[model samples]
Target: MKKLLFFIFLLLLFSCKKEIKETLDNNYYKKARICRDSKHSDSAFYYYNLAKNEYLKINDSLGVGNSLVNMALIQTDKGDFYGGIESSFEANKFLRRENDSIFRNRLATNYNNIGLAFHFLKDFEKSSFFYIKTLQYIDLTENKLLCYNNIGDVLISQQKYGLAKIYLEKAYLTQNSTTLSKVINNLAKAKYLDNKNYDPLPEFNRALKIREIQKDSIGLNSSYETLSTYYLDKDKNLSLLFAEKMLTEAIKNNSPDDRITALQRIITLDAKNYLNNFQHFNFINDSLQTARNKAKNQFAIVRYDVDQKNAKNQILIEKNFQQDIGIILLALALAITILWYIKRKKRLEQEKEIEVKNTQLKISKKVHDVVANGIYQVMTKIENQQHFNKDEALDELEFVYEKSRDISYEKTDTQGEEKDFSERISETVSSFKNDEVNTYLAGNDSGIWKHLSSKNKEEVYQIIRELLVNMKKHSKATIVSFRFERENDLIRIFYTDNGIGISGDVIYKNGLSSTVSRIETINGEIIFDTKIEKGLKITISFPAS
Candidate 1:
């Protein structure tokens, strides 16, 4: 009983595995067929992905590559040129490793699909190259009729009507009835384009005969339409007859596109007729335009479908990228939060240290100014009493005592003791100037003093003082001029020096750097224009309001 149960279990397990593999293979082939029929190219891509994944799991490299090539065909049909190229290249890579004739022919089909895509893109050079390559692996006799027709179509689009006729003629000679009819129609058009007016009529007639024989209503409608166009200049009666025939066939076939073309031809021929046909012409023209618009809308829908599929793919990619970015951003935020907390803690500690240092500085300044000066003064007086040549020393001691007393008095008297900013600036400039460095000041207005806040006034004074000091020390200037002009809501300060001008390459250091920063502290634009042999001119403009 145990042995029988074991045998039954093994049979069931093997059957299940075979069924699963067969199911996967059948699904893959069915999906490929569906994709080819419906032109749902993105869906085709997804299915191709699934098919290739399953094939790879079974270690079928050739199957995987063939699946990729099939996906490339769908991409090419949907106008994804770059994608088609990439897919074709990937398929070729795998195909190179396989020495099978069938696989090589599959690679040729991929090349042909790529060529067709490029032809639609109007890249004739690349299209020709790949089309020629299609013949390398596949027998020309087997698929040459289709290949020749495509070559002729491309050539006709390129306006190579003469060469197009030869290829079309070759395609027309083929045994395939459908290819022969298409080739005949193309050959007729190529002949018309080539200015061989007599040659097109026979070709058009032959294509029409084939369509009639085959009972292809669509092809008959197309042939009649083209025949009507060819006879328009040569024979108006014949043209009108064919045009009416085309309209009848288009209506019978229930093809809006063909009906639209037929209506257009009828309308054109009606215009060239007598005034009695005017109303008919207008009616047909209106109907044709309306139909054309409808067709355009349909084309737009096709484009929209393609775009929607692409947008969905893009959304998938963007969603994945965003998830990754979100994770990275979360990590970055946590790291930054940690860094900020550490910095904040360090800053608080530094602030506490600064408070302690400030307290010590206040005590040290008091001791240096008051106690040290008082002790020196007392020592000088005692030396004078001893007649130790202390007269000159006593004068110096008295000056130090007076300075210390003023410091103490200033520290205590906090009422109306703030120095006038303009006066302070003037004194600093005066101290900086001498015979070697001449300083010129212009447009000093006392009203300008009242307009400034204490902080702004101090900043302005420091900026000016620092600039003058830099000019005296580094500029090597003989004459320095400062001009202040207040106009409207703007204040302009101009500083010019007849110095060996600084080059553009010169780097700012020390006081000059401080001056630049101070000017920037206020909302001002500083422009420095200098020349090698000329002078340096600095203009600062401040918005007064």
Candidate 2:
């Protein structure tokens, strides 16, 4: 009873310790969020790093991912674009690819921030690629429109005006008032860039008016800069006025990049004060670059320290991982062995079923040729003869009956080689001819049958007999012809009949299906030209060797 009480106490103690650690981690995360909300980015990033480290101690991957994403966004805002991209990539390593909406939102935010950083760095290709990645995970309609606009902006930077317009126009149609001015500005820019004669002043002014009414200072800076650029070639004095206005708004917004851009425009348009504007440009540009460099280095150092701590933790993880891996590998090997055994057994059963099916098909073909075609041949002969011989017809019918009884046994016909094959074919066709039908055969020579194997000859003999049977039964033709030629390594045969033609869609029936199967067994091709107006024409060809 004492031992049981001790064990229970220990379990409760461990659970309490875990809960306390999680509470501490949550406190750090809360502090980070508070700092970020108050615009204390540096303090927020520091707290987030602490939160991330605490989450790592408890193996809280989602917490780690969230902290890293916030860190990346701060770095991007501070102009450390390379550092931001690195941090975002590292966050993806910790984020689990679950279908949870929160996870997807975080994933999209990470990729979109990466795209914004790359855009600022002027890596338009990478910017566009990451923007597209954002689109895949972002579910919100507003966020998706923003991604499309980002892609359009990248396209515009690359001078792909037509493609930029495609995305901008799509975003414009669905944009709310918050996004309307931005979309319209980009659309107008694409139009003006694509066609030199396109007057973009009205659209640009409309966008500017919307921004002014919304009191969007950052947007106002953009509008003023665009107006300055538009009039630079057409009206220098008006362009200089817009440049001065842009500089004033950029200063009010504390946008260093915009201020530098406006300064360059003023130096060109206001030549009298060129030196003054140039000096101001150099100072702000140099200071901004210096500040950006310092932030980049600081973020890099933070990431490097985190990596070092992770490396130390990984050493402990590796020892336990190796032990687990041995057990896993043993289980995997047993599973693979069982799977392979099952697959092999299934394969053997499938092979046996296929062998049975092939044998049945062979026997069925024998029945059709020996019994069906034989009976038809005897009937044709009797019907064509002027003086019917009862004894001869009875002998032929008796021969067919004997073949049918022994059909189950696969007996090879060796008698085919003993007789002249050409004469046999000629005799078969001649027996089919009657007062109503005239049949002709050409190239029925012994030399043509010399190179053919006994199997090939039998298949060919069966195929010819099947065709003649079909013609006698269905084709009410007055004339039929069969032409044969041996060219180099191939034999070609053409069969034609002047009767009511078959339809364009050739359906093999009345033993014609079996005839096709026979020809294919010897690697032969047969084409039926039912398109002919009068009767059917078939061309059969096969390799000789």
Clash pairs for candidate 2: none
lDDT of 2 by residue, 88-183 (tens): 898888767648656666677788778878888888888889888878876667657756777887898889999999888878865566467878
Candidate 1 regions off by >4 Å?
A: 1-29, 34-42, 56-59, 78-86, 97-99, 195-197, 217-225, 235-545
In order, candidate lDDTs are: 0.66, 0.78
Clashing pairs in 1: none
| Quality of model 1 by C-alpha lDDT | 0.66
TM-score of each: 0.41, 0.53
Report the lDDT of model 1 for residue 242. Answer: 93
- Best lDDT among the predictions, by candidate number: 2
Q: Write the per-residue lDDT of candidate 1 for residues 30-83, one digit (tens) a residue.
A: 686587568665566666666665665555656666677776665554445566
- TM-score, cand. 2: 0.53
